[model samples]
Target: MDCKVKLWEVYGDRRCLNTFIDHSKAVRDIYVNTAGTRFLSAAYDRCLKLWDTETEQGKPGFTNRKAPYCVGFNPGEDKQNLFVAGTSGRKIVQ
Candidate 1:
């Protein structure tokens, strides 16, 4: 998949919640916030995207480094300002 994040409502009938196509390459990893209100995605396209879970909408949130292999929200103290990402360059960005 070159660029797609398919949010599915696995509860009940199991269907799509939303479809986000912001990356130009395969999305490598996804992470959710502790409160469940938001989430983030890192992709091979060297981009990170943040989503408002309740509204099913998103925006490009982070970028500037190499393509990432993983991304996650940081919880507990200072959580709102902290996010983590792992890149193929063998470095972690926070």
Candidate 2:
């Protein structure tokens, strides 16, 4: 529960590639887009963030009163930019 998100290399050396230290609380969920250009992270800090895969820079996206539990990216090409976040408040937000 260090409130950090990590990226690891799948090939060769097999070491951590980067660490995202943005959340103030434990990160509960993460979703990566189909093309892997972006990702989303939901945390118990009651915040959701969007990140650039290559740059590792993140910006706040959603800040609900309730903590977010999960996140997912839209798979359809027509809605590729859309994503959803499910919160502990029992609501799913887009």
Candidate 3:
């Protein structure tokens, strides 16, 4: 069965600005880019979704080979991004 996690943007005093639905078996990890332009989520669905934070919508991103336990973006690179996901084994999707 697929489950979803709600994403929320917190603002000072306001608490939340936006909320989104994550359609995955289990949302295990999330990574926001340094520019805050995008959000990457890894889940048991064995997929990673890149989302546009500005629009609060999903963007085309990478996919994993198995259920990802973690997701992160590598630093020190411009124009290029690195996504590391911990699945049944280590998988790197760039």
Clashes of each: 0, 0, 0
- Give the top-scoring candidate (TM-score): 2
Q: Kindly report which residue pairs in candidate 3 clash with one another.
A: none
- Report residue 84 deviation for candidate 3 (angstroms): 2.3
lDDT of 3 by residue, 1-94 (tens): 2355455545657455665566547677788888877878777777888787788888664666767777777776574366666776665445
lDDT of 1 by residue, 5-58 (tens): 787988998998788777778888888888777889888878899988788888
Two-way lDDT contest, 1 vs 3, winner: 1
> In model 1, which regions exceed 4 Å deviation?
none
Give the higher-TM-score candidate: 2 or 3. Answer: 2
Worst 10 residues of 2 by lDDT: 53-62
lDDT: which candidate is best?
2
Task: For each candidate, give its TM-score against the true structure.
Answer: 0.86, 0.93, 0.73
Model 2 backbone overlap count = 0
- Give per-residue lDDT, candidate 2, residue 5: 87
Provide the overall lDDT of each model, using Cα atoms, as 2-decimal numbers. 0.81, 0.89, 0.69
**lDDT rank, highest first?**
2, 1, 3
